[model samples]
Every structure is written in structure tokens, then in C-alpha cells.
Target chain A: MNVFVLFKKEAKEQVKTYRLLIVAAVFLLFGLSTPLLFKFLPEILEMSGEGIPIEIPAFTPSDALKSYVNSLGQIGVLVAVLVAMGAIAQERERGTIIMTLSKPVGFGEFAVAKLAALVVTFLIGVALGALACFYYTTVLLGSVDVQAFLAINLLIALYFVVCLSITLMYSAFFKSQLAAGALALVTLLVMGIVSSIPPLAPYMPSALMGWGQSLAVEGGGSAWPALIISGAIIVAAVLAAWQVLSRKEL
Target chain B: MTEAIVCKGLSKRYGRLLALDNLDLHVEEKTIFGFLGPNGAGKTSALRILAGLSRATSGKAWVAGEEARLNSSVLQRRLGYLPEDPAFYNWMSANEYLTFVGELFKLPSAELAARRAELLALVDLAGAASRRIGGYSRGMKQRLGIAQALMNRPAVLLLDEPCSALDPIGRLEVLETLVKLKEQKTTVFMSSHILADVERVCDVVAVIDKGKLIVQAGVEELRQRFAHPVFELEFDQPADSAIPLLQKVPGVTRVVTENRAGGVPVLRVHVTDTAKARHGLLHAVETSNLALRRYEIVLPSLEEVFVELVANHKEQSR
Candidate 1:
């Protein structure tokens, strides 16, 4: 119940600070620009050629979806992490958490509420951005399957949650937001790199994003296990953060 | 009297640094208790443990008969804490912040609104309730912090140096609000190094030094326990003449005199019993027909007691 109350407060704060709008705008720009960027790739290459033979991939509507997913997957994860990097660090640094924690609110409640609020905000931003990209891709190149668009978008959102969790956990554990943000960025980057190895590909959460993109493109490659693992990791990270934060002195 | 707060051998440590030693404290219901200590004297640590925001490394704390640990939500419900530097979400308006705090306490909607209005008026922030906290002056922010702390109508209010950060005028404002809170019968336990503030508002006082309690008692009791009564008198008599006459009084233990450059000689009479000394001195003055310009009993100040106790504690430890 306290979590819900805190969630409401956090939601209002996100709106007041224009963080909601900024995140939505960032996602929207990516969505609107990805299709346009990919659709004119051949023309763009031809115009800038200096006798360099660039073997461009076929720019189909599927490629447009791939570009959109990759864009959201990479830049969107960063946006999500950076946006939430200050969730707990700022409160602790500014000493606002002191009075709040003195209430009947638990560390878990505070953390979960913050995560829920940001997840909703990020989800809404991603949905709007994805819709814009989906519309432009359909009109410019060709039609995209509605089911695949929804499924792929959901997978990318899950990835965003993972990044958000990492950022928030560090924010609770570290005193400085910059340190937390850097650590989260490094952790995600390392995971992303390591998960690409052939042996680890099936078990890694990053593989879910690849599977989602592939399915959207050629309607193949299931990543159900990876999706479940990523979801589990997110939950674990949040719990660990709560435990650490509960032990923290002021 | 019912115990509003109790700490039994509470201790806190950070690695090798012992922030709080084994400490015991008791606060009765509806009393304004002042925790007096210099900076880094572990006052905040004790308050935080009682507030349930931090845990003691050893020992235990209780609030309103409930165990108070870091995760003790039940006890937390009955405790209102204002940290040394109370911080708020700068973007939030005062009304919004108070509402947020009320929501955390799970107050019902109707009661929450009513309480909010009452608290805003109590702290004199009703006019600026809609202004963002970031735009608020330090005093306004402090008042808002106090309002939020009282939103739950907590059984015990723990304030860590509420007036230490304010200007003189701002300090007076907060002190005034606290005075009104006292009338509401809230059990207020505040920590401060500012002796005058504590002396003004506190019914009970505890002096702590270097992770140890130097003394804890009612303000009047502490003064009586550690301070001696001394009376200062100004007359036309010289030091040699005044000393013998004052010393001859029955309850007067000793008398010393100092001659000012261009004024009358002053006599300080140390007394064993103030009542006996007062009667004897007045009788002697009247009988002698002494032109008494000034005769005043110098009651010991809390500052003197605090300094003596802390200095003695430091010397003993050394």
C-alpha cells in the first residue's frame, strides 16, 4: 500500500520534472527517424559515394523494423538507465530519504514503487515511439505484422526494464548518481558483449532482443527461456537493492 | 508517566569508528526532551535508531512500547522524525509534499486533507502551501519539514537539531512552532548543541559527549544537581569590608569581591541554601541600612551545566 502511494508520488514527480515528456520525446524521435533513415539508405549511400563500394543490406520493411529494434535496444536502454539513474542516489544525497524512511515505509516498498512508476512511464514512451515507427514503416516500405510488432516491442521494453533495474540498484547502493550511472552502464555493456558468444547465446537475456528482432524480420527464432531469465534477473536485482538499502545508515 | 521512547545500551559503529557507545535513554510521554551534545557526539545516530531509519549495532530501542529496528514498520508508524538537514523533493509544492507524507502514513483522504490544512496553519505556511519547496526560504522549508513530521500525529517526534541551521529570526519561528506543538501534548525529543534553544523549550535535558551520556534529567534537576547557587551584590562598600559581612551570613559558604574601575565594588556570595542566604542577606542589608543598588540570585544556566559536565567527562576519559 505504501508502495502504491510512493508510486503515485513518483509518477507526479516524473511529470513535474518533465522526465516523462523527455523520455517520450526521445523514444518518439527514434521511432519517427528510424524508418525514414533506413528507407533512404540506398539513395543516401549513392549521393555520398567516393568510389567506395558499400554493399548495403536490402532495405525492406523488415530491415526497417530491425533498425527500429536495434535503435531502441541500444539508445533506448541508455535513455532508460540515465533517466532512472537518480532514483535513489538523488534522494540519499539530498537526504530526502531520511524523513521518508522514518515512516512506516520499508526499503522494498520505496524501491518497488520507484521501479513501478518508471516502468510505466518508460513503457508508455516506448509504446508511443514504437507506434510512430510502425506507422511510418508501413506507409514507406511495406506492411508489418501487427502481432510481430507488438511482440517485438514488448521484448524491447523488457530489455529496458533490465537496464532500469541495474541503474536503480546501483543508485540505491552508491552515494553519487554519476558513479551509479557509470557502474550500471558498464555492467550492461559487459553483459551485452559477453552474451553474444555462441555458447552463452541461449542463456543470455540479450538474446531475447535478437530473437525478437529476428522473429519480426523472418518470423523465426524463439527466446522464451531468455525472456523468462531476464524477468527473473530484474526481480532479483530489485530484491537485492532492497536488502542493501535496508541496511544502509541514512 | 508512560515511556514514549526508551533506548537500552544502544550502540552504532562504522568500521573502526564507534559512532555511538552503549547508551541508554528514557523519554516520558508528552515531555519536550532535549538531547544536548556537540557536533559528532552521536546524537544523530541515537535519534536515527529510534526513528527506525538506521539500526544500532547492539542494544535495542523501543517507541510507544513497540520494538524499534530499522525495518520495524509498526514502531515507525508511531514515530515522527526530522533529520538534522531535512531535505524534500524541491520540485514538489508544500501541499503536495505534506499530502505525500500523509499518504505514506496511510491516512484516509478526508482526514488527510483536514490534517494538512491544520498543520499548514500550525506552521504558518498556509499562505505559501502552493509554492514549490525549491523556491521556499530555509525557514519555510524547515516549517514544512516539521509539518510533514507531525502529519501522522505520532506518539513521539524525533527532531535532529531543528533550529541549528536557521538564522536568528528563522530559529525563533521554528521555536515558536515547537512551542505550540508542546501544547498539543506531543512527546518531542529534539537533539541540539545550541544550549539556549534547549534551555528555552526543553522540559528534560540529556547531555552526551563522545558517544557517552554525561547526564540526563529534568532541566531543573540537572541545574540543581550540577550547579551551585551564587548571589551577586553591588553596594558602596570596598571588597575587604563586603566579603566579611556576606560571609558572616548563616547559609553563605564563601564570599569574593571585585572592585570595578569607576563603579561600586561587587560581591559574589556562594550559598549552601538559597532560602536561608536570601533571608539572611536581606536582613543584614536592612539592619545595616546598606544602600543596595543591586542584589540578584544567579541561577546556574544550562550552558554552564553542559560545559562543566562535558569538560569533566572529557577530562575523565583522557
Candidate 2:
């Protein structure tokens, strides 16, 4: 119940600080433009091809959705880190944490509330982006499988959650937003690199992005291990953040 | 009276510099207790430990019968704390912030609303309660801080430099609110370097220097115990010649010369024996041929007592 109250305040803060609007706007921009860019790829290539004859294949709905997933996977991760890097760091820096923590609120509740709010923000943004991408893909390219597209978006959202939670953990570790953001980015980059290795790909949270891409292009085996591991990572990150804030001097 | 707050050998160390050095304190219930110290004197550190905002490196503390430690919800619920520089979500209005704080304590909707209104009115911020805190001045923010700290009607209130950012009128308003809190049987432990405010509102004051407790006593008791009587003498002419004569007077421990505005020479004589010093000072002035315009014995201010105490403590430690 205390967590709910704190979550409400955190949600309100996200909206008032324009974090919700900014994240939604960035996602929608990518969502709408991904399909459009693909539909016009041949023309764009020919225009820049300097009159050289270019062989181009017709675009498919799968192609458009896959491109959208990739765009969101890369750009969305950056947005997630940037948005969450200041979650706890700025609060500590501004000394607002002292006032809030001096109440009947637990440190775990505080940390969990922050992650929950950010998750909701990213979920809304991802849903909007997915709807935009689906609508445009149906009109410009061929009709796509709605179930597959939804599943793909769910996977992408989970991947972004992993990013947000990791960044939020670092936010609790450092008082400087720049340091937190840099370390979180580096950590994600390392995870991305590890996901490319065949042996480790199934266990890495970054593999969820691969699962989404494959789901868009073709029905394939599920990355259940990656899915389970992603959930664990998020839980661990939130707990780590709570522990850091509990021990912090602010 | 029962003790609302107690610290047994509470010590905090930052690197090699000990901010609080085996400090012990006891604050009685329903009183405005002032924690007095100079800058970097571990006053904030002690208050933070009591507030459960920071942990002490060693020793133990209890507030309202609950052990004080970082992130103890039970302890937090029993007390309200306002940091030296209280910060809030700047994007939020004072009304929204207060509501949020009330919700943290799970105050009922109707009761929370009433308490919010009452506290805002108490701090004189009801007129601008809906305004964003970012737009507030420092004094306004300080007032809002006090309002939020009272949202739960906590049994004990810990405030660090509560009036440091307030204007003279704002300080008076806050001090008055503190006095009223005392009337309501709430113990308020406030740490401040502003001796005048503490002297005005505090029933008991504990002075600490360099992380060590120097003295603790009631206001009048502190004045009487640590303060010496001072004699102020105003003369029409220069009293430079009288300094030597005054120093030779019996019971005169120290003689300080001052030039009042427009260059009127005055002498302040700090004495151990007020009766003997008074008579000898007058005789010394007569012998020096200085025309004495005024002679009065003035009780020492808290400022004087504080300086003298800290100086003596430092001297003794050396």
C-alpha cells in the first residue's frame, strides 16, 4: 500500500517532468518512420545511387515490423538509459530523498516504486509505437499477423525494462547522473556483445531483442531462458538499488 | 518528564575526521530542545543520526522508544525530520507535495485534507499552496518544509537549521509554531548555529564543539552557569588611559575597549565579582579623569556564553 502511494507520486513526477511525453514522442517517431523509411528505401537508394542501376526487392510487412523492432531495440535502449539514469541520482543530489525517506516509507518500497513507474512509462511508449508501426505496415506493405506483432512488442518492452532497471541500479550507486549513465551504457554494451556469442546468447537479456526480431520475420523457438533471465535481472537490479539507497548517506 | 530522544556515546566518523566524538544527549518530552554548535561542529551529523537519515559509526540512539538507524520504518513513523536545506520536488506545488507526504503516512483522505489545510495555514503558505515549489523563494520553501514535517503530527520533530533560510518575520512565525508544538506535547529537537533563535525558543540547549558535548542545561541555567556579568561604561572622552587603570581593579578579569558609532569610547569589563568590580571600576574611572557618562551592568548574551564555552573547551582540550 505504501508502495502504491509512492508509485502514484513517481508516476505524477514522470508526467510533470515531461519524461512520459519525451519517451512517448521518441517511440512514436521511430514507430511511424520505420515503416515509411522501408517503403521508400528503393527510391532513396536510386536517388542516391548516382544513376547506377540497382536491383531492389519489394518490401514485406515482416520486413517493416522487423526494422521497427531493430530501431526500437537500439534507440529505445539509449532512451531508457537516459531516462532512468537520473532516477535516484538526481533525487540524492537535490536532497529530496532525505525528506521522502524520513517518512514511514521503506527503502525497498521507494526503489520498487521508481522501477514500476518507469516500467509503466516505457510500456505505454512501446505500445503506442507498436500500434503506429502495425497501422503503417498494414497500409504500405502487406497485412501482418497481429498476434505475432503483439508478441514481438512484448519482447521488445521486456528488453527495454531490463535496460531501465539496470540503469536505475546505477542511478542508486552514483550521485552523478553522467557517471551512472555512462556505466549503465557500458554494461548494456557488454551484454549486447555477449549476446552475440552462440553459447551465451540464450541466457543474455539482450537476446530478447533477437527473439523479437525472429518473431517478426518467422515463427521460431521461444527464448524462454532469456525471458526468465530478464525477469531475474530486473528483480536483482531493483533489490540492488534498494540496498544501495538504504546504505547511502543521503 | 520522560526522555523523547537519547543517544549513548553516539559517534560518527568521516574518513579520519570524527564528526561526532562519543557524544551523549538526552532530550525530555514536550520541550523545544536546541542542538547548538558552530560550523562543521557535527550538529548536522548528530541530528541525521537521530532522524535515521545517517548511521553512526559507533554507539546507539533511541527516538520515541524505537532504535534509531537508517531506513527503520518504525522509527521514521514516530518522528518527522526536516533537513538543513529541505528539498522538494520542484515541479510539484506545495499542495501536491503535502498531499504526497500525508499519503506516505497513510493518513485517511479526509483527515489528510484537513491536516494539509491546517499545516499550510500554520506556516502562512495557504495563500500560495498551489504554486510550484520551484517558484518559491528560499524562505517560502523553508516554510513548506515545516508544513510537510508536521503532516503526520509526529510525536517527535527533528529539524536541522529550521530557520536558517527564513526572513526575520518568517523566523518569528516558525519559532511561534515550535512553541505551539511544545504546547501540544511534541518534542522538537532542532539543530542550529543561530543562537538567538535557539535562545528565544529552546527550553534546554546542549552546546557541542568539534563533535564533543561541551555543556547542556536549561536556558536560564546555561546563562547563569557559563555566563559572567559584564559592565558597560560609556565615557565622553577616550578611555584608552582607563584601560590600564581598569585592568588593575580587583575582580576585573578582562577589560575590552570599544568605540561606539561616531567615536564614543566605551569599556566593557568582564568580572568575577560584580560588586567589587563595580565599585573599583567607578573609582578607576575617577582617577583616570575620564568623564563617565553612563554605567550599567548587562547580563551576558547567549552569543557571549557560546563563544566563551567553545574557547574554553578548545583551550582545555589543548
Candidate 3:
């Protein structure tokens, strides 16, 4: 119960600090960018008012949500990785870890609370951006199924959580805040690289993003197995980090 | 007397170095016990072991009548420790820090609030409770450390060199507070090399050297046992035959004279008993007409006692 209360307190503090501003900015950027890109593409092709043979696809509210997912599944998650990389690592850098560990709450609960904070931020950011992008895209194009769009938004949120969890584990391992942040960015870059290759692409975590994005765009074709597998990997990685942490001296 | 803490052959190794070497201790409840030692003398290690911050490599400890390893939670609830040079969450205010610790100990909301207020005032940080700890001075931070340690109103308080970082005024104020706790019958265990602080606050004292306890006894008793008092005399003129003459006296074990600066003579007379020896030496001084310039009793200080004990140990080992 105390751990839960501490978790809530930490959550509130996290929101007050740059988390809210960062989430809002990213969401707003995605919300405005999605509709503008869809609305102006045909006009841009007509620049110099020349005859262009290519035709733009029928824009819909669903397209906007899909666009946002692709953006977030890549850029949005990358931003989150940067913001959360030092979440635990900064504590160790500033030596607050010793101060906090002196308290009675076990280390697992402490780590769990921090991970929960990142997940909450991800949910709020993705949810707000999805809602905005839906409105603007609908006005520009036409109405679409809200359920499908929201489903895609939820997937983006979960993907963000998965990304944040990995960085949190790295933050727990590294002593320096800079190392944690750098390693997180490097790890994500390596994921992107490995998944882009021809032979090894299917086995990489980046493939999850690409695969999940396509399913989200097609509306309801996505199976739950890949998401569940990623969730399992997150749990296992966090557990391994926690085990190493349990034996670490202050 | 109720024993609050009992350790048997406790030891802890850090790589090749032994921080604690088969240390044993028995502390009585409701008493102020001072652990006196120089730096790197394993005082911190012993305190950490009791507080569950560090594990012991061998032997066992009973804290509050429970095995330290077996009942750490129950023991931790009772033992409040403030480490030497404690680092706090600089971003948090004193009130928030205390609240965090209080919640960790599972105090109810009302209880935590009230205790936080009381401890802040007790440590003279009431006005600064809302200010960030990063801005606090070294003395203020040390006080906050003590306040956080006392949040649970623990039964056994272990302060590791709590006054070491403090300025003179801060040290005096903290020493006064510690002594007040002693009067309240709190079982307080504090470690320091400052004998004056220990003498001012603790009723029982333990002298530690090289990770070993040199002596542990009541303050007055240890003074009586290990520390020897002697009377020294200096004269303008050296007594030509005073050594043999002084040795012939009933109480005098030996008489020695050595040259001091300015070619003056100094007398060192060791006797079996301080009071009886001073009496006989004074008598000899008067009868000999030795042109005495100064006569003073060199009652060994705690530092002197400490140095002598350590020196004797080294000599015996060599």
C-alpha cells in the first residue's frame, strides 16, 4: 500500500516536470502534421499548377490515426526513450538512490513505480494526439470508424510502454545518466538497423513496430500474439535488471 | 540490565581487507553508549550491520533480542541509524524527506505529520522544513539526517559520527540534544573519535583500534582501568643524586630526570598510586630543596589514553 502511494506521488511529480510539456508538444505536432500532410499532398503535386498523372489516396480520419501511429511507433517512441533514459540513472547519479533505498520499500516496488510513471505519460500523450488527429483528419477528408482508429491508438500506447520499459532497465543498470541515455538511443538504433536488413529483419524488435503499424492501418487484421510476446520480453528484461540491482551496493 | 544489542564474533570482509574483525559487543538498553575510534576503524561497518545496510560475513548479532539477519524488519523498525556523511535527496525538502521515510515505516498519515513537525523542531529545522535540502549547509543536512532517522521514534538510535561534520556551535547543540536523549532513557549508540563529545553525552564508552575493541566499560570505570595519572616536576637545578634517593622511598617505583629545553631539568616520577605518589613526590620535592619551578599532575586525557593503548598493542605485537 505504501509503495502504491509512493508510486502515485512519483507519478504526480513526473507529470509536473517536463513529462506533460514534452507529451503535449509531441502530440500536438503529430496531430497538426498528420492532417496537413494529407490535405496538402495533392496541392503540392500540383505546384506550378502542372498536370500530374499520380492520384492521392482517399483521405479519411482512419488515415490520420494510422499516420500518427507510424510517426509515434518510430519518432514518438524515440522521444520517450530519450526522456525516460535517465529516470532511474539520474537517481544514481545524484545519489538519491541511496536515500530512497534507505526507506523500507523494497527495490522492486521502487523500480515498478518509476516504470508505471513512464507508461502513464505514454498513454496520456498518445490518447490526446489521437483525439486531435481524428478531428482534423475527418474535417479534411471524411468520417471513419472511431473503434478502429482508437484501436490503433491503443497499440501505439502499448508500444511506447514497451520502449520505455527497455530504457528503464538500462537506466537501472548504468551508473551515469549520460551512459543510460546514450545506451538507450544506441539500443533503439541497433533495433532499427537489424530489423531493416533482408535476412535478419524478421527477428528484430524493429520488425514489431513495422508489423504492428501495418496491421493497425489495415484495421483489425493485427493478431495479439506479437504484442503479448513483446510484453513478455519487457517483463523478462526488467526482471533481469532488477536482479542485478538487488546485488548492487550503494 | 536489559541487553539491547549482542554480537558474537561478527566480521565483514571487503575484498582482501577486513573491515570488521571478529568484533563482539553487548550494549545495555536505556543507556548512552559511545563507540570511540579513529577513521577507518570499522565503527561504520558495525553500525551498518546492525541497521541492515550491510551484511556480516561471519558470526551473528541479536538486535532487540532477535537475530539481526533473521528478523531484519522487526530490528530495523527499532534501530534508527544516521550514517557518517549521509547524502540525502537534494531535490526533496526536509518535510518531504521525512514523509518518505515515515511512509516507508508505515506510519499513519496523522502520525507522520505530527512526528515530522516534532522532529523538525527538535533538530531546529522547523523554519527550513520546506526549503530544498540542496541549499542546506553541512550542519543542517546532518541535522536532517538525524531527523529522518528519528521519524519512526525508534527504540535504538545509532548515530555514526553525527557531529563530525558540524561546526563548533552545531556540534554543541547536537551534543546537548544527544545528552537530553540520554536522560530520557533512550538506548543511544553513537560513534566518534571526539572524546569530549562522548564524555559529554555517553555514560558507557568503548575504545576501538584497528577494527578491534580495545576496551569497553563504563566511562568512569575505563578511565580508572586503562588511563594512568602521574605528577611531573620541573626544577631550575638538577638534583645530582635524586634518582637513587627517590627509589629508596616506600611508594616510589622509579625516579627519572631528563634535560629539557634551555638546559633545565625535568623530573618524571612513576609511583604505584597517583594520590599516594603525588604526596610522596611533593614531600621529596620539599625536603630536597630542588629549586622547583613548576609542579603539575599530568592526568592522562582520553586522547593520551587512546594513544598509549594503541602504542602498547603495537609494541606487544612487534
Docking class of 2: high
Q: Considering every candidate listed, which one attains the maximal TM-score? A: 2
Q: Fill in the DockQ of model 3.
A: 0.27
Summarize candidate 3's per-residue lDDT along B129-158 as a digit string, tens digits. 999888999999999988888887777888
lDDT of 1 by residue, B46-66 (tens): 988888878789999898899
Question: Every model's DockQ, to 2 decimals?
Answer: 0.65, 0.85, 0.27
lDDT of 2 at A28: 94
lDDT of 1 at B119: 94
Q: What are the per-residue Cα lDDT tens digits for candidate 1 across A90-162?
A: 9999999887888888899899999998999999998999999999999988898999888888888888898
Q: What would the per-residue lDDT of candidate 2 be over residues B102-207, giving only the tens digit for each residue?
A: 9899899999999999999999999999999999999999999999999989999999999999989999999999999999999999998788999899999999
Candidate 2, residue B119: how far the Cα is off, in Å: 0.8
Q: Model 3 misses residue B287 by how many Å?
A: 18
Task: Give lDDT: candidate 2, residue B84.
Answer: 94
Models 1 onward score TM values of 0.88, 0.96, 0.81
TM-score of chain B of 3: 0.82
Model 1 whole-model lDDT (C-alpha atoms): 0.86
Alpha-carbon RMSD to native, per candidate: 5.0, 1.8, 5.9
B-chain TM-score, candidate 2: 0.94
